[model samples]
Target: MRFFWSTLSAIFVKDIVTELRSRQVLPTMIVLGMLIVWVLRMASEAILTSKAVMGPVALWISFLFSGLLVQERSFAAEQQHDCIYGLLLAPIDQGTIYLSKLLANTAMLCIFEIIIVPVVLVAFRLGPDTRWPALAGVLLLGNIGISSVGTLFSAVVRVSRARSSLLSVLVLVVLMPMMIPATFALLTVFGAVPETLQGTGALSFIGSFNAAVGYMIAFDAVFVVACWLLFGFAIKE
Candidate 1:
C-alpha cells in the first residue's frame, strides 16, 4: 500500500514538474478554454439574457474542448526520448501510473475551471445567488469522470499515429453517458431546469439536483475502477 502511494506521488510530482518547466499543456488549455468561452459568449449574444441556460452550457463546452488537449498531451512528454519505455520498465504498477496521470490531469482541469468558471459567471451574469457549493460538487465529479476515462484511453491511444484526434473521439464518445447527467446537474445547480421536469413522476427525479450528482458519483467510481483495472493491458506495447 505504501509502495503504491509512493510510486503514485513520485510519478504525479514528475508530471507536475515537467509541465511547470515546459509550460506546455496548461497554457494551451487555458488559452483555448478562454477563447472558447469568449466565442460562445459572442455567438450567443442574443440569448445572453438566459444566464441560467447559457452559463452552464458555455462553461462545459469550454471544459470539454480544452480538457481534450490535456488528455492528448498526457503522454506526450513520455513519448519524447523514449521516456515511456523507461517508465514501463521501472518497478511501478501500471495502475499506479494511471492514477498518477489521472490526478495530474484532474489538477490541471480544476485549475482551468477555477479561472474559467468565474469568467463564465461574469460573462453570463449568473449572480451571487448561485449555489456555489453544489456547483463545485458537480464540477468535481465531472472532472473525475472526464479525467479517469480520458487518462485510460490516452494510454490506449498513446502509440497510435492519429493519437490526438483519436483520443478526442474516444474520450467524447465514452464520456457521453457521464456528460449528460453532469450537464443536467450543472443546470440544476444553476437553477435552470425547465418546469416540465419539475412535476411528480418517475421522470421527476431528473429535476432533483442530488440525483444527477449521485449518478455522477456512480459514474466516476465505476469508470475509475474499471480503467484502473484495464490500464495495464491498455499500455502494453
Candidate 2:
C-alpha cells in the first residue's frame, strides 16, 4: 500500500520537476489559454454580456484545447528521447503509469484553469449573482473526464504515422459526445436568458450532467487500466 503511494508520488514529482526545468507545459498552456480567452472575449462581446452565459462555454473551450496542448507536450518530450520505452521496461504496472500521467495532466490543467478563469471573469464581466463556485466545479470535473479520455487516446495516437494530424482527428471526434455535459454546465453558468424564459432546469441539468460524468470516473479508471493492458500490444508493432 505504502509502496504504491510512494511510487505514485515519485512519478508525479519527477514529471513535475522535469517540466519545471523545461518550463514547457505551464507556459504553453498559459499562452494558448490567454490567446483563446482574448479571441473569444473579443468575438463574443457584441453578442453577450452576462458571464453566466458566455463564461462557462468560453472557459471550457479555452481549457480543453489548452489541456490538449499539455497532453501533446507530455508525450512528445518522452518520445523525442525514446525515454517512454525505458519507463515501460521498469517493473511498474501499466495502470500506474497511466494514472501517473493522468494526474500530471490534470494538475497542469488545474494550474492553467486557475490562471485563466480570473481573466474570464474579468473579460466576461460576470456578476455577483452568478454561480461562480458551481461553474468552477463543473469546469474542473468535466475537464477531468476530458483529460482522462484524452490522455489514453493521445498515447495511442502518438505512435501512429502522421501522428499529429491523426491525433487531432481522433481526439476531436471522440470529444464531441463528451462536450454535452460541458456545454450544459457552461449554459448554466452564463444564465444569459431571463429567469422566466431560460427555464429553472439548467441548474438541475448541469448538476445531473456533472454527476453523470462524475459517475464515469470509475469507468474511466477501468478504461485506462484496459488501455494500459493493451498499450504494450499496440506499441510492439
Candidate 3:
C-alpha cells in the first residue's frame, strides 16, 4: 500500500516538475481555452442574449477542447526520451501509473478552470445568485470524470500515429453520457434549469441537481476503477 502511494506520488511529482520547467502543456491549454472563450463570446454577441445560457456553453467548450491537449500530452511527454519505458519498467502496478497520470491531468485541468471560470463568470455577468458551492462541486466531478477516461485512452493511444485526433474522438464519445447530464446540471446551477426539469415537487431544481451530481459521482467512480483495472493491458508494449 505504501509502495503504491509512494510510486504514485513520485510519478505525479515528476510530471508536475517537468511541466513546470517546460511550460508546455498548461500554457497551450490555457491559451486555447481562453481563445475558445473569447471567440464564443464574440460569436454569441448578436445571437445569444442570455448570459446564463452562453456562460456555461463557453466554459464547457473551452474545457472540452483545451482538455484534449492535457490528455494528449500526458503520455506524449514521456515519449521524447523513451521515458515511458522507464515508467513501465518501474516496480509498481500499472494502475499506479494510471492514477498518477489521472491526478496530473486533473490538476492541470483544475488550474485551467480556476483561471477560466472566474473570467467566464465576470464576462458573462452571471450575477450574485450564482451557486458557488454547487458550481465548484460540478466542476470537481466533471474534472475527475474527464481525467479518468482521458488517462485510460491516452495510454491506449500513446503510441498511435494520430494519437491527438484519436484521443479526442475516444474521450468525447465516452464522455457523452456524463457530459450531457453535466451540461444540464451546469444549466441549473447557472439559473437556467431546463423547462422540462423545472416546476415544484420531485422534479424540481434541487432534485434534478442532486440527480446530476449523483450520476457524475457514479460515473467517476466506475470509470476510475475500470480504467485502473484495464490500464495494464492498455499500456503494454
lDDT: which candidate is best?
3
Clash count, predicted structure 1: 0
Query: Each candidate: how many clashes?
Result: 0, 4, 0
Q: Cα lDDT for residue 65, model 2?
A: 81
Reference-based lDDT, each prediction: 0.84, 0.69, 0.86
Q: What would the TM-score be for candidate 2 when compared with the true structure?
A: 0.82
Per-residue CA lDDT of model 3 for 28-74, tens digit only, reads 88889888878878877879668788888888888888888999899
Candidate 1 residue 126 C-alpha distance from true site, Å? 0.9
Off by over 4 Å in 1: 47-49, 128-130, 194-205
Q: Model 2 has how many clashing residue pairs?
A: 4
Ranking by lDDT: 3, 1, 2
Tens digits of per-residue lDDT, candidate 2, 7-122, equal: 77778788888988989778877988888888877778777665566676677788778878887766766678898888778787666777777788888788888899888888
Task: State TM-scores per candidate.
Answer: 0.93, 0.82, 0.93
Query: Cα RMSD (Å) per model?
Result: 2.3, 3.7, 2.9
- Candidate 3 lDDT score at position 184: 74
